[model samples]
Target: MTTSSPPHDLLPLAGDFDPRTRQDWTALVADVLNKRRAEGDRLAPDAAAEALVTALDGGLGTEGLYLREDRPLGVPGAMPFTRGRVVRDGTVPWDVRQLHDDPDAARTRAAVLDDLEHGVTSVWVHVGEDGLAATDLATVLADVHLDLAPVVVSSTTDQPGAARALLDVVGDRPTAGGNLGLDPVGAALRTGTTPDLGPLAELVREAGAHDGWRAVTVDARVLHDAGASEVDALAVAVATGIAYLRHLEAAGIDPVDAFGHVEFRVSATADQFLTAAVLRALRRVWARVGEALGVAETDRGARTHAVTSLRMATREDPFVNVLRGTLATFGASIGDADAITVLPHDTVAGLPERFSRRLARNTQILLAAESNVGRVTDPGGGSWYLESLTDEVAEHVWTRFQEVERAGGVLAALEAGLLREWVDTAVAERDRLVATRQRPITGVSTFPNLADTAAERRPRVALTTTDAAFAPRRDAAAFEALRDRARTLERAAVTVRTIGAQRDFGARQGFVANLLAAGGIATTDDTTATAVLASSRAQYGEHGRAAVEELRAAGAERVLVAGRAAELGDAADLVDGEVFDGMDVAAFLGDLLDRLGAPAEGDPR
Candidate 1:
């Protein structure tokens, strides 16, 4: 059939579409039609394609590429746990669990009471070699209202003594809800001895065979707190749980009945998204496990216990850890964890001071009461970014879980060093970031007032073993010499100082300059030679930048920046350029000098 020209073809178009001058190339009919024409021939080069080719050839150096591909994210609450389990009916925030790890029963009891008074709804009594004993269980549970509160206990073994003691304390109290952790996988990981899974399975069967008690599959907080990523932590946890379930099933317990008694104790880190995503992904994977065992999907969810991670806490900035714990608490709660325990901010320093404990309890209280963080379920739902991140994390974890399974499940993975290697890689990356200050820690890395710490306070008990346990015990003089060396180095370090009303800005810049100087630059060693600039304005800008440039010109490889908020913007730029994002500043400077044909360092020409 013959076709007539369109009315638009009869009129002249106005805008230019030429490569040289086109305002909108999309309107060019030839270019648009040429796409189809070129389909049978060859494709034309574009900036993106050229860039990709150049990158591939190592010409125009770039980091990576984006390829659009879709992978299956199992339905929410489905197998392999790609998305999440438990589509929220509404926001039913996770239970609040505070830890009572005191070796002394009376002290632990006091801590438990204190936790209860501060809006804590659950208590986790740790009974490791360093934790409380079964003998202390009674006093720990005494006077605490049991109707609504739940307690969880962890030990190195599923020894009958620990379980019998715990069960005896909670006997006949309608509200006496708690789990005696029988995590053989975790026990094995910590103690270097594989547990007799037969006893563990029997314990599970016994717990499930009864009522108001549980034998949990404890993953423990050690993995995450020891530097494992969310993906590794959750994957290992799921694998461990599955390993337990298999053992139980083989022991003639129903598969569905097997998982019903297990509980997970995971670490809650400062990475909020990661923590939340780990829980969500865990639920999904667990649901699949339940399905594999012929359990109804609706009844597949397991109780999750979260504890504040010790790995990220710093002995230097003890109080600032309060903020990290708060974030972790909120993340764990929102992640639908059944319970959460926020470690005292100063717990890393040994014992938590009363003030530190108060701060720790207050953090959770503020999140739950004042912030009302517990009122919403899946609070992160429907967010494109969070959802996408949740998917990515779930997929990553699922892949890792499969790898673990292929290696004969979680315990086998650990035994074969797969899990340790995974954790070590992540730990190395995190340590590198911390060392470089790419991830700035507020009080510890940035500020220095090491001697300004308050009076010492001991914790009810130490959860972590000291270096003395691993290393040979040193005599008093040897220890003193080590301390003296540290003190000497601290005194020899460069310090930056910026003057003027712009105190905060200058302080931050000085912080960055000092960090650089510590990294090998020969800046002024005097505390006064630290980068310091005086400015009238309350903001940071070119004046600050110019000051930094002048400092650099004056052989001040590291200069402290000081300024007000007005000067902060400029100081931030300088730090960002010289320290944080500027990984190749030295090379760039050398290139500039070479381009100018300036004499190289130590050149005699």
Candidate 2:
């Protein structure tokens, strides 16, 4: 049987343009830049034209072949569901899941009731440490109607006990869409100790006896928090899911039934497009896996749960994290996740206050009810850019999955430290980008608020035991540490000396000011400041030296110039150093703080 091709007009740019036209467009761009250069503009024609083309084309030359292709995304609820699994017909809202981690059982119970009573559709409880103990399951969920509002329990070391406690509460009544959240592989990966999968399998068998309950959870957010790339995280998630399916099959469970027993959890970050693409890619890859296993098309698509990225949350200017969570939640919705959890803005600080928890829940409520973002299925469907990106992400993730399979699967890869090595490399590159400001963390590395008070401290109840496996890390941790050092000083101030007119120095002035403020150093125009940052777009022929000397004469102990080093000329000798893009911002600020007599280590403010 042959399929008919889509109508010519229905295809993207079909017959409307030719690839050869790119040469003509490039020539036209070059001509414009050449004319500008002839008119005495200090621009390289070829370079300027190339940049213009890149800006207009929406793809960088460095992105290689991945950015150049436009792939078709099939209809939603179909095989290889790159678009989505279920068609959300504007009536059913995505599940708004709230996380409950308060260790006080009574408080946790009250909070859970409050959340469910207000807007939360489901509750995710952490059992142990900063979360409630498994023994408190009955107390915390006493008021909850298990059949109406689903409850998900997560435990690090006590999955079996937690599952049993939850099941005991669930007792006899058919569970209404709850997940046992028994993840033995996740526990093993985190603690670097193999957990006996027997209990988990038993729990799965027991849960299988009930309706609307899933036993296994494949959470890839651990890998993501440990600095794994998108592909790496998705690959690990797929491998874990496959491993669970195999294990269950080995235990006399049907393959399709075992597949249905699992759910996937991934991280959603502030990068909306990437988050959406990652989720889309995950579903497609999982669908392919199910197809290979001969599962029905309806059972192939993954049931995804998206949690806001922990690595993206900041302790500094944490209010910005609300915005991040909102964006991530939106991205997750567009990506067609079955459920989403928006972490409280202050989560990185300590146990979240009532207000923070309310805000976290309300964020999803507002998106679903107010903005009506859930009114459409696969909102990003049919967009050329999203489709192309989704396909690219799926390809890369499948390749990584293949590598893990070749290495004898996820557990073997983890035991051999190959997964950690991959994640560490990604972490190193991410750290390098963060340090150099290539990947600017909004509150910590970019527009830092120096005058903002520190986040309120809360005594955390220990929840999970730390192990030697891939540890959680935040991209802003190093930068926040530098700021901590600066905060210890009685007075941390840097003078920004502007040269030439406002237009000439405005950009560099702001640049140097933000850089200094990022390290908790206030920028001042006062002569009392010991350090001076000279900012200018003007050439440093003679005026630059005079500015540096003037700062030195005005009680400045160290002088720094924010401009090209080559332009410093004779002023290079007068200034302590140069500040520019791609510089080690943390190191530069640390040295500056030390030179300015930062308080000794362990000295209290």
Candidate 3:
């Protein structure tokens, strides 16, 4: 049998200027800049001009590079599914899965009921240490109809106990629509100890007996929170799923059936396009895996559960997290996830209060219901940029998957520490970028609220069986620590010595003030300040020098210049340091606080 080619009308056509390449665009930009210089228009600096060219050419870095050759993206719901698995019409919206890990069974139950009563369609319960115990399953899920509202349980080390408790509550309900989420491999990776897969296989077999229930869950969020890149997360997920398939097959289950009992959980960050592309690429990779196993395309599509990235949440200026969660939920919806969970805004700080949880739930509700984002299928499908990104991500992830296969699969990699090594490198790089403000975290690294009070909430209980090998990390942790240090000081304000009028120094003043505030330092214009930050534009060099002298003469203990240290000329002699973009803000703040004689880390003011 031969398959016919796709219709020509359905394919994308080349534009009239198709022959024009990125090089041609670069040349044009250079020519325009030169012409502007000749016309005495005072063009942007050389560094800034080149940066613009790079941004226009989509060549900022590996993450920024994308090719146009991967266009058209094929049809939605087709093979490889780079667009999506199914063309969603507006009738059915993506499931809003609210996560509940409150240790109090009563509170967990109330949160669940409140979510279901509002807009949530599914419940994800954390069962184990630091969360609801297995014994509280009955109380937590008391009125939750197992046959109607799907409930996914995340049972880390206590899988067997949690499974038994949930099974007892579920009884012999054939129509129960929920997932057991028994992931031994994930637990092992998380806790640095191997679990007995024999129970896992048995649980899979038992859970497979029910309808609309998945037995094993491949949680990429574990890798994600541990600082894995998107490609690494996808590769690890595929390898994990493959390992589970083998486990179930060894236990007498068919490969196709084993695949059916698996689900994927991934992290969705504020990078909406990257998040959507990663999800789309995951489906493609899974499809290939299914094909390799001789399964049909229809049986290969993955059921994805997307959660807002924990790495992106910040304790300082927690309100910005609401916006971040909104964008992440939008990305997940665009990526065509089966269900999405928006973690509470204050999740990183501590156990989220009712108000924070409500905000998280409503973020999804507003996007799905009011924004009408669900009405369109593959909303980002047709764009040249998104399609190109999707294809590149798929290729990169597939290559990583092959590497994992060669390294004796995910389990071996995790045990050998190769996976953790890769993730640590990525995490370090991400932290560096966050530190330098190359990737500015709105509230943590930029526009921080120095006056913001600590969020009043219950402290999160520690998990007893945490793996020191692959412990979860937050990108904002270092900055938050600096901020915490700042909060302890009795007097930690910096004075901004504006050189010249507001127009000359306003921009630099704001920049310096925001940077200081991010480290928990307030800003003042008084002479009583321990340090004075001199702000000025390039044209006001003399003014800046005089201001620095004035501040020093006025008995300011230390003076810092804002802008390039070299641009300050003789003014640099009067300043203690320079505050500018790409500087190590955290370290600078730490040194500043110490020099100013602020209280130490544990000191109570």
Candidate 4:
């Protein structure tokens, strides 16, 4: 005979542990804070609570804890719809949109069919520069059922022609959904060309007679790819949308009708919380824009397509991207995104294989089916933390949007190079964090898997960044550069000259070894090495300095210190540089490579 416990009481679970209150938690945190703070500069109760605040761009930030007072409420399918656009009662959650960019027409056709046959709801094909050509659209979509599987096309150099080509294929197909992908502004930003909305306006007007097709997709992903903050993306997307609205209006299309024609494609990063908040904010602010333009409240909700971040993909340990994609998809699902696309894990290295593409689409399927992540409506609505963050993001976005309008909107800002400045600033801060390892890019900057082998793929057409066009970038490029150089150069003889026993020097020795491994270099204990790094702040400080100097005098070409160089006092001049947390690892490794003849005598920088 078994006894059932109380259904919702704490007594059963708290059999041994004592119950704790907010005060108890605060007190414990206070103890830790006081220990870390300087003596006599201790934080008071109020300041202690705020000490864990995390700063974000545009003065938006998050605190360690949010309280009841911070809560702001909203319902699903309501005006200023921060919760969601629709209230679902066990309905299909979101569209699983997968991207295909293979240049081969036959391969793309096979992949597109495979994706649609196995849980994928929509196809996002990239046409032009390095992607499928315009002539190949017919072949790629030959077997795809236009009524069942929606196809959206994006292009850089082959814009209006590509849009027309897709339309020709769709012809008079009933229930054909998806976009013509005539994002003139986005194409201009990507290809450094002047935007002409005449074709887009014409498409929107002509497609109005049809049932399920949109004209333009105002892709805000360009902003994120170019290293803009969420605030920048929100502001710029609004500005671009309005710009399109006015252009379409000038060409005799109503604002309300134009609203239905444009869709937004935004970036969803691995930071799930921030990603959710930003997406919510995008919906909220876009609703306000529609209201300002005299559109009905119900039609104001922005249709958003969330694509998992391309910038977060790593080249070396590509497997880590599985987790990244999963987190991004979770964020998009909870954030009430209409559709999502997950770029394959090995995307940064080259073209993704069939296995990579399968994993990408299945990521969304597992979350939707097994996890039931989308069963709940507005999962973040009740949480004080998410609500506060959403409000903050929305407010900041409005401020920036107003600023952009004052500067004559998105086109003018691009012309004035103001958008470039914003992207540059955000990129600088992001780069600084990665350089210092404060951001800690797993498998690249921190805890890297040195023995992992790179998966080889066919050579892909390289994408580039310029002052005129927003471009894609990877954070691991710096460390990867070091690794590339190390691969080409002769392996260095790196020895750790330990000053103390295991208890003292072991930690620093391990740290030094890890740092070397990041550059694809190894370490040894051989005293007669090309380079030696003195490890530990052993009790025999002077003796340690003398030993390093002796090694350098005997035959060592380069000598570095595991600890701070200043710690050696008079012998500081003998050491080359210091290796420690927050040090410029790139510059250190680059200089070392130069010393080791990395360029191999003839290659130009």
TM-score, one value per model: 0.68, 0.89, 0.89, 0.92
> Which runs in model 2 stand beyond 4 Å of their true positions?
1-72, 462-467, 500-504, 598-605
Candidate 2 RMSD to the real structure: 5.8
Task: Score residue 577 of candidate 4 by CA lDDT.
Answer: 54
Candidate 3 local lDDT, 1-605, one digit each (tens)? 99997766643566544586666555665566666365555444443346463220111123223345644466666778766777776866788899998898888889889988888888898989767899999999897877778888896668788887887888886544888888887777777677567787788778877777788888988888888888888888899899888887888889988888888999999988888988998998898888888887777777889999998888878888899999899999999998999999888778788888889999988888889998888888777667767777788888888888888988787767778787877887777777887778887788787766458778767765545546688888888888777767767788886777777568878888888888888888687587778777563366666777788789776777777755666665555656475688777888888866654334474
Task: Give the Cα-based TM-score of candidate 1 against the true structure.
Answer: 0.68
What's the lDDT of the predicted structure labeled candidate 2?
0.81
Residue-wise C-alpha lDDT for candidate 1, range 178-263, written one tens digit per residue: 78777766765655566567677666655654466688746745566556666777788888888887887788877777777888
* lDDT of residue 383 for candidate 4: 81
Top model number, TM-score: 4
In terms of lDDT, the best-performing candidate is 2
Cα lDDT for residue 112, candidate 3: 89
Best-to-worst order by lDDT is: 2, 4, 3, 1
Instruction: Give stretches of model 3 more than 4 Å off.
Output: 1-24, 31-72, 174-176, 465-467, 501-503, 538-546, 570-574, 579-581, 598-605
- Superposed on all Cα atoms, model 1 deviates from the true structure by an RMSD in Å of 12.7
Q: What global local distance difference test value does model 1 have?
A: 0.60
Whole-model lDDT per candidate: 0.60, 0.81, 0.79, 0.80
Where is model 1 poorest over a 10-residue stretch in terms of lDDT? Answer: 468-477
